[model samples]
Target: MIVLFIVLGGLLWLISLLLFAFSAWASYKLMRLLWGKIRRALLRPGTAQITSYEVFTPDPEDIHVQDTRPQIRLELDCERHGQRFQVSLGPLTCEELFPALDLPAHHIACWLSDEDWRQLLEKRWVTIACDWRLRKAILTSQIRNDRRLLLISFLSLSLFALTVTLSLLPH
Candidate 1:
């Protein structure tokens, strides 16, 4: 009976230790995942400093040079200081450029000079993409929360089993 009690106690201790270890591992994994998400959010395209520019459909009068097509054009315009420049955007595609432009639904398509156009595009793309990614991260966090809860429950159950086995052993 003494031997049985010792054995049972030892088993319980081992099981509890294992449960604690697993719980710690799960927590570490969760922390790493959160860190990765934060890093990605900070570093992904458009999240960092503005790097490029674009021009959507511009008014013919506003455009210094006119082209037959009305497409949106993206240009690298970081160096042009205050000078109004014009670039011909061949054609405007609402689906492809609207989200990138971050224009309001009620806003009308108007002409913007090359400089103003670049600034607007840089601001629009950064703002929209950041918002979209934040929403996506929130959804992913919700799912991960559920998984973490399940892992905790499993760990608790293992601990419970250890306690029960110890109690049932003969004195």
Candidate 2:
């Protein structure tokens, strides 16, 4: 009778350990899922259109290549409100801006080769949150939604970490 009781208790402990491990793994997976969704949402970004764009090509003859680096000046027009602003950015290749964004081969190729910057800017609407300086002007209702999602994701991650830490502690 004593031997049977000990065996049953050991089995229960092993099962609980397995359950705990599984829950931790599941939480991690959930966190990753949330992040993927958030990234995808950011890929399209906010409601803004580029009315005009200027690409400043550096002169090879210029000695100060650092200062005369390839820059793009964009005239952003917010669709939500009739707000207009100018944003200056460096060359934004598909590989640079959306490195993790899984775009089609043709789209990536077009973005890389397009001299006029049409493929990236003129073709579609972009997020007004192009530069940090313009954050105050651009951050509207969309920012709130993004913040809520981020908060939830962080909380989930923190909970997962705490669970793992507590589980690792000596019983």
Candidate 3:
């Protein structure tokens, strides 16, 4: 009976480890993808006049405070020959918390060029370039943050599984 319990515990541990490893691998790939996106945004630096901005909030998980920022997608009328495009800016993270704890919607803190900000507030249609540095910073921040959250969740789950398994063993 003791040997059976031990074998089961080992199996559980192995399963948890496998899950952690897979998630870590996924996170690494995602980080690389995000880095590539940042490089592309920097390289392109497309010009467009703002039509409007659409806010897209992902299913707000109470994952962590840092993961709470909503994504803002820009609707633009491109400059060269008046082509229209919806350019992705940043899924920006912010320092401030949402006003209500129950509310999933809140503002995010992110960097933007002064001119772009003013134009954003005034709702003026002005030609704008992709703010390469700010976009890169936002992407980097999100990559690091999501990885951190994944690790934390994995650790917590592993700990819980260990505790439950050990307690069930006939000591």
Candidate 4:
């Protein structure tokens, strides 16, 4: 009877460990998949159109013509062209665009200009080859990390199970 209890407890513990390890692996895989999609979007040749644009201000009134200074202007350039267009962007939207453009959020504002904005608007096909190339690199790194995590988890779980099973056998 004591042996039976010991074996059952050990099995339950092993199962729980396996479950946790798998969950972590799944999380890593999901992150990698998302990173892949982002990389593709960024790296594909041609300008991605400016699908949308926004300007965000904590106080709407701050954006009013009467206001002397605005905190920052956010632009959403979906197209890869160097055209000019007016688009509004909020802080959150800026964050979302960073991964898509493969550029740091801080650098985005610097790239904005009247001529560039006009070009972006005029260029129907915005080539984002540079962005895409950078994205590809990032995705590759993510995939490598995910693979490493999976390998580690599988090995740990196997070793643990083996140890438990051997311990339970007659010596």
Per-residue lDDT of candidate 3, residues 1-171 (tens digit): 999999999999999999999999999998897665544444433344445655545666655644533545544444333534444443333321111111243343334454644454234342244433333222333344555666686799999999999999999
lDDT of 4 by residue, 1-171 (tens): 999999999999999999999999999998797665544443434334444443333564555544222233333243335543433333333333444455555544634565654453443332233342222122223334555666686799999999999999999
Q: Give the TM-scores of the predictions, in the order they appear.
A: 0.31, 0.33, 0.30, 0.29
Choose 2 or 4, whichever is better by TM-score. Answer: 2
Query: Tens digit of lDDT per residue, candidate 2, span 19-93?
Result: 999999999999887765465345434545667666665677877765343455555654334545555433543
Q: How does model 4 score by TM-score?
A: 0.29
If the candidates were sorted by their TM-score against the true structure, best first, what order would they fall in? 2, 1, 3, 4
Q: Which candidate ranks first by TM-score, i.e. highest? A: 2
Query: How well does candidate 2 match the true structure, expressed as C-alpha RMSD?
Result: 14.6
- Preferred candidate (TM-score higher): 1 or 3: 1
RMSD of 4: 11.8
Q: What tens-digit string does per-residue lDDT give for candidate 1 at 77-100?
A: 121233323222214443444543
Q: All candidates: CA RMSD in angstroms?
A: 16.6, 14.6, 14.0, 11.8
Q: Which ten residues in a row have the lowest lDDT in candidate 1?
A: 131-140
